[model samples]
Target: MLQLLRKIAFPFSLIYLLIITVRNYFYDIGVFKSKTPNTPTICIGNLSVGGTGKTPMIEYVIRLLETRKLAMLSRGYKRKSVGFQLGNEESTVLDLGDEPYQIQQKFPTKSIAVDANRLNGIAQLEQLIKPAVILLDDAFQHRKVNPHLSILLTSYACLYPRDWYLPTGNLRDSKREARRAQLIIVTKCPTNLSEEDKVAITRQIKPKIHQKVLFTSLDYAEKFKDDLGQTVDDILFQDKQIAVVTGIASPEPFIQHLAALNLNFEHLEFSDHHHFTATELKRINGFDVVITTEKDFVRLNGKVDSLYYLEVAHKFSEKDKSVLKETLESVF
Candidate 1:
């Protein structure tokens, strides 16, 4: 039924493509104005609706620029609060959204703010914290604020070139808009991807001369941590009645990682950023061990007593690592 519906939606996808093409053209030709921030800004986003691993890439860049005073601005997708809400000691997931709240928990010292308006978010962050650089989360298609540098993310398994517009496929923006990015990273690749495969993928992407493409693999942590600050290794999962829970856009990679560890568990997957109901929580509580991703853990922590989260980060090859660093340096 879903496949049939998607096939029927192809004409609607064409309509979406036309609408976005005109919108982008207006922005490009200055019929619509875009504001440039006074502070150096870099945007990390994907053309697709979700599942490009933007959060992990943002965290990776945050770690790379540890010496700088950083502020991150997000649209705060699906959060309860409205207007510009800045992360503080009292900020909750309801106020800043799951991804921003997770980032705030991980890096409490850095400034994190969310507003549907990217320009207003940047201005509030500047007025409040005066950060050296601002990282715009999931704002590649947001043409209202022209970023100084933009990094576009595309998954190795599902490249944007092969995707169609929304309701039929995952792409939310036109593929031609990818040219705006200064750097493009292929996320969620296998660690053992060969050089020939790299060349093939880059050739397939056909990035412009100014744009550099890099590959990254998801590096899961060896140990898992729970809400009480307790850590456990994968060996311990062999004896436990495990339930692997995930509320993320891409859970297959995470599930495969556990399978690679040779662990036994029941998989309980949900839509990305799903808010669990009381009945669902009770169902999940039946398992002896509930494991999830860090982003999901932020929303599930106090609700699920047996919850534990595994951390994942971006891992690049030595050569790609140097290229990424040099590209970021050039951004400033």
Candidate 2:
């Protein structure tokens, strides 16, 4: 049924594709100008719509560039406040979007700000503090500010080459736009990705001569944690029944991670960036141990006592990490 609906929407998807293609053409031909910031700026984005492991990839970049003073800028998707809002001591999930707020909480000393306009956000961030490097989260399609280095992410399961435009498929922009990125990372791969798999994907993506492709997988933490910093034993979860609550674009990997542990759980899935209501909170409170993604944890932290979040990070070979580091250093 869903496939049929998507097939019916194919014409509209073509229309969307044409609109995006023309817009990108204007930028390419210099009809639309992209501002180049004085400070080094890096963009972590995806060719598809969402769920390409962007948050963890951004965190990976942050960890890699820990020696330099950095600031993160985002569009603050679904945030309540308007205009350029710099993250401060009082910044909450409502002030910055969930992902930005989560990153701010994790890296308290680093500056984080959000504005729909990337140019304005960068200007404001520079006026406040001159960060050595600025990281732009999910700003691939926002061509107003030209980034010195752009890292494009695509999921192993749903590569952009196999996707279509929005309302019919997952892609928000044309697949050809991926050529703009210098580094293309295939994220959320299985732990044991074979060489044959790499060759196949590389052929499908057909990256430009200057583009480099790297593969990475998600490494879940050994244990879960609660609001009060209490750790939950992984052994205790063996054969135990728990509830999995997630409000992210893709939760299959997370669900499969928990299932691999031989734990039984009922998944209570919600739309991406879903804001929990009072009634939903009451229902979630009934669960004994509710496991959620780190992004969702920010919104559900104080809502339930039994709620715990599973931490995830990017897992890549040291050689690949070195390649990424070298590429960024070249821009600096």
Q: Show model 1 residue runs off by greater than 4 Å.
A: none
Per-residue lDDT of model 1, residues 1-332, tens digit only: 98889989999999999999999999999999999999999999999998989999999999988888999999888799999999999999999999999999999989989999999889898898989999999999999999999999999999998888978998999999999998999999998999999999999899999899999999999999989858888776778899999989989999999888888999999999999999999999998889999999988999997788899999998888888777766656
lDDT (C-alpha, whole model) for all candidates:
0.92, 0.91
TM values, all candidates: 0.98, 0.97
Stretches > 4 Å off in candidate 2: 238-241
- Candidate 2: RMSD over Cα atoms? 1.2
Q: Least accurate stretch of 10 residues (summed lDDT) in model 1?
A: 323-332
Question: Which clashing pairs does model 2 show?
Answer: none
Q: lDDT per residue, candidate 2, 1-332, as tens digits?
A: 98899999999999999999999999999999999999999999987779999988888899888888899999999999999999999998999999999999888989999999999999998889899999999999999989999999999999999988977999998898899899999999999999899999999999999999999999999988888768787776566567899999999999999888877889999999999999998888887778899999999988876778889999998888899999988768
